[model samples]
Target: MTTRAWVLHPDIQTNRDRKDPQPALEEAMALAHALPGLEVVGGEVVRLPKAHPGQLFGSGKLEELRQRLTDQEIGLVLIDGPVSPVQQRNLEKAWKTKLLDRTGLILEIFSDRARTREGVLQVEMAALSYQRTRLVRAWTHLERQRGGLGFVGGPGETQIEADRRAIDEQLTRLRRQLAKVVKTRELHRAARAKVPFPIIALVGYTNAGKSTLFNRLTGADVMAKDMLFATLDPTMRAVDLPSGRRVILSDTVGFISSLPTQLVAAFRATLEEVLAADLILHVRDISHDETEAQDADVRRILSDLGVDENTRVIEVWNKVDLLAEEEQLALIRQAERREDVVVVSALTGLGVEALLAEAEHTLDEVRMRKELILSFSSGKQRAWLYDQGVVEAEQQTDDGFVVTVNWTQGQARQFHEL
Candidate 1:
């Protein structure tokens, strides 16, 4: 049966990291909707000067919320912020409903959406870690009234301890499995390295049209949806640019503001593709009200992942079709002033050709230094290298010339063929 859930964004005034409650609540509701079998009956932003240690809400406010939840028959309460285990248990008891904090809710959505073996293992490990912290002593039902036999932790091993141990074992097992999966992934990455194609990674906040743009550019049937986190697994496809250069395009998991710490640690292996990319396209939902905030969040995550400061990044202003014509024109004009920005609508295919051309041009500008030995009989090829303006230095030898050249990949390929 579908669970009826109510979303709550606790607007703690004294909290240092408080966001605009309205948008936060909206995002929370969207997150709830993204998960399966949860019908969000209603949602609201509850104002508070501070949080209650025991119940998270003030006494009277707690009763009022409880009454309303009872009236609406809400079986679950989704809090839009972190809730301690004590507060969660107390609130659930008082409100007569199940509760999930922001981290827990995101974990649930990830658990439902994970498709690949590595993704599943990562989610499972994160969920186990989260569950470990929630095993409070208040639940007497989990505590053994009598002593245990000597086989377990001798004598008085409480069920809570046993449960914790079990979770720990599962986590250890998952880590082993994840290590194997990661090694296999590393092997595949190594294989791709030999293909001589520049890897371009598309990264951005969730639902920022990275997958749509990937599909548009590569004609790959990757899942593209309006919902948040529609793409979780890293997908790669070789796209042939108009310049006849093949480059690998990688669509990775989208980032979000205040991403769960467990997920960050778990998915770092998956995001290695971004680290390996020759160029990064930072996609943004230009129409979102919090677009700037979202951009900051993505950049912050990238920095946390150790992306180099000198990494070449092109800002892609996506979803231009959602804007007014005047707004679109203004954005286009603004983008034209910046060399690193591209305004395109992945949905309508507008400016997609320009994006491809820009990508090719950017790749072509990346120069690689090479040393070539040309036979005396191959003077035509030697002249061709000089014609390309790539011959940096040359030394005469008995049978050939040893030439040092700094050239783009395209130039290098052309030289090798000659």
Candidate 2:
């Protein structure tokens, strides 16, 4: 049976930097809908002057919400912000329903969506870390005595302590396995690095239509849906631009505001493609009211992930099909006035050709000019440079030849290897 769930966004008035509560509540509802086997019956933004340390909600508010949840037969309550273990326990007991805070709910979604071996292991490790913190005394089972070997905790050890130890052990094992998986990924990256194609990464807020754009650009059938976090694993495909330039396009997991710290840390490897990208396309749901806020969140995450300040980025205003004709024209006009923005609608393939042409132009703009001297015996190297169409001018010299070439950083590196 599907679990009937209710969502709540605590709009704490004391937090001056809080996002607009209504949009935040709407996002929470979307997140609730993303998870399977859960029917979101209702959601609302609950106003509060401050949080109650033990229960999150005030007594009167808690009683009112409890009655409403009970009447609707809500079996799960999703709180749209951090909830301490004590607060979660107290709220669950008061409301007589299971509870999940933002971190827990996101973890659940990742656990369900993770498909690759590495992704599954990463989720398990993060979930264990989260579960470790929740091993409080409130759980009756944790109070039971555990018989332990003297090598570990002594006899009469509490089950909570034993459980924590077990989680630690599992974490250690997962770390070892993850190390192996990451090594394989690194090897794959090294191989790609030698392919002489610039990498272009697509990054954006969840459900911002990145996968749709990725499919449009590469003609690869990746899962593209209107649901939050529809794509979890990073996928890449080599695409040929109209200028005959081949580039690797990577579509990665989407970013969100107030993402769990555990997930951010754990998914760093998954997002390594973004770090290695020669150019980044920051896709945006231009029709959404909170698009600007979502853009800020994605940029903040890229910064937090140590993306270089000098890396080139282009803003892709996507989902223009969702807007009115006048709105789309206005966005197109605004984009035309900017050098680093492209207005597009991935769903209807609008402005995609222009996007590709712009990308080609941007890459061409980053090419560097270099001079190289080759000996008479380096005929193969000279031929390779000519084949790459990077040789601008060549002069025969006493040594052999002095060649001036215009190429990208990747091409320069490949020339050196040759």
Candidate 3:
């Protein structure tokens, strides 16, 4: 199959700070490069001087784009901006090509890349939810069954009704399946409570070098790339700290501005991976111009997810290699004043050891301290306590064993129950 795309964007008079159309065009090309069958013919940034409620851009611009589309022989229209369902349908009709918004493009990339069952389910759920809202006409062919299997574009007797019904059914089943995944994840969380190792989740804008850091620390080759959303499914690996203690380090889906709401809801199962984390490492591109704003956006998202409170979040200024020595020094000075923030270059491995040591120290510090005294004869019980919680400070007396255990509040209760 030959794949070609035309890019479109509608920007208001304000919000000039929106990502340059070039990166989005570059993103489209990058995705096309990753997917073998894809070919990007050409792309243009059509600025809408005034918004058209129905079409998003003026009819005159649409006419010019249609001529360009015909001349270029483009098969797909990729909109770099958000579009209403009505606008999407109208644009497809007007342009006479398959139209995809930024959301749809992301979903397509995710659909192709998802490997694990949970990953596939999450992508399918997002696609289904997005498709449900759009309800584009030609998409009906995607649903029909013939010869015991549905060919995506095969002509069918009962096309519309069969496809819609099947989509609905698949959606229902997908929801249930996702619920089971969520339940299994919750069970895993409970198991983690049995041994409270502090979790550190790496979250940042896609292509900000999260997977590289994950591989460097954990020795797991999880598709490290310089492209966007390289790792859709959350991958966790045990990171052995310098003290021989291990903690769960999760490489989660990278964040971006204007993430589709459907995608957010659909990937809740995967996102719960972050919720269980005891600490969050907000890796960022320090050299990027939008670093602070991107940081703000990430914080806003974490707050929306209700993971902000009491979470030991450390802002890691990653990719400092892109900066000069003076700039690096300035960033380090800035980091010194900011609590729970550090500067490090994941690419060159600069300051990574210090970052890890600081993370472990912070993890050790925030734990709830408890005072538990047990008789010396309570050998098994004492051993259980020792196994369950971290002994911050211990003193074995002749009459008994007096120990101060540093654990989460939940673990403290378990100790008392023992």
Candidate 4:
């Protein structure tokens, strides 16, 4: 309900830096003002030296903070950035209060925002995995094992240990259930492979208008909001390109500068949607001052997920309608050297067609070329290859038939033995 956030400030110069911690502090206050049960009463920051890590704050500072929290009645100390589990434990123990890192708070938010069945499952999975490591934070006393045949008989007997044991079992069960979901998803992906629709996934920081753009292009009424994690479950809908060629557009979980690692892995199912994508649309909020820093965080997360750096990515600088003449022109020139870039305002439908034109072109290079030869006897099988990709050339032979097929890595393998 209340937080005494301990922030660690570092002095580092970067071209694209996130908004100052001051705004987050202010934003935290605003949130408490809006939410009935929440109060971000006060906070403190320790500006550590470049190489200092032992204790975020020296003994004197911790004592001062202890006194400040006592005066403020702070119930929680939210570390506004990454902290080691050890440091987190130490900080909470020293401050004699509950602690939450930035990641934990974000996961809590996602857990609160998820609406659909899939969304809920993903959020729970993330929350459990995150909580799994922080078991030491438990405040209640442990209970003994309980069973139906136990010597202890009770009508309303409570079992804390039994509840946790049940949770462990449920955790395993949920993992298996998620695996099933993933496998079923893989099957759907395989079917999509047969259809050969180029997947164009829209990814950006939360509330960057990804869903709005998705609805404009696909005509689906997905819930779009001016809130964090408005869209939790990835929604993929068919969008007709400028050439009438259909490609799937997926609206995924929006990225945040300090997105939780637990949530990231749990949302791997959703993020894998990006990995499976034919082209990644790095949508940005050009209107926001933190746009570039958000982009860097997104890129860093993508790289962690093994997304190829050389993968075909289209940078979409959205909200250009909100930009001034000089700013728009400057961004245009900045994006000029990039192979694929567009300035579009999803809200106003400006430059949408131009972006679609680039989409069509980007889809063409989704798969690299691999030439394969098939004999005349495999005519029907060769026809199947054409379904997956273009057939650059074909030929006839006396012994049988030699057909050259241009296909993807998977299709070429399928064509080799055909």
C-alpha lDDT of residue 71 in model 2: 96
Weakest lDDT window of 10 consecutive positions for candidate 1: 138-147
What are the RMSD figures for all models against the true structure?
6.2, 4.2, 6.8, 6.0
lDDT of 4 by residue, 226-342 (tens): 656677788999988877888888899888766777777788876887876768898888888767777887888888888766567888989888888898888788778777889
Two-way TM-score contest, 3 vs 4, winner: 3
lDDT of 4: 0.70
Model 2 segments beyond 4 Å from truth?
139-143, 147-156, 369-418
TM-score of 3: 0.81
For each candidate, the alpha-carbon lDDT, in order, equals 0.90, 0.90, 0.77, 0.70
Candidates 1 and 2 compared: the better one by TM-score is: 2
What's model 2's overall lDDT? 0.90
Tell how far residue 80 is off in model 2, in angstroms.
0.4
TM, every model: 0.87, 0.88, 0.81, 0.76
lDDT of 3: 0.77
lDDT of 2 by residue, 1-418 (tens): 8999999999998887787999999999999999999999999999999999989889999999999999999999999999999998889889889999999999999999999999999999999989999987743453487655668755566777778899999999999999999999988976776566888999999999999999999989999988999999999999999988899999999999999998998999999888878789999999999999999899999999998777789999999998999998998899999889999999899989999988888888878898999999999899888777788999999989999998776566556766
Q: Which residue pairs in candidate 2 collide?
A: none
Flag clash pairs in model 4.
376-401
- Give the clash count for model 4: 1
lDDT of 3 at 221: 88
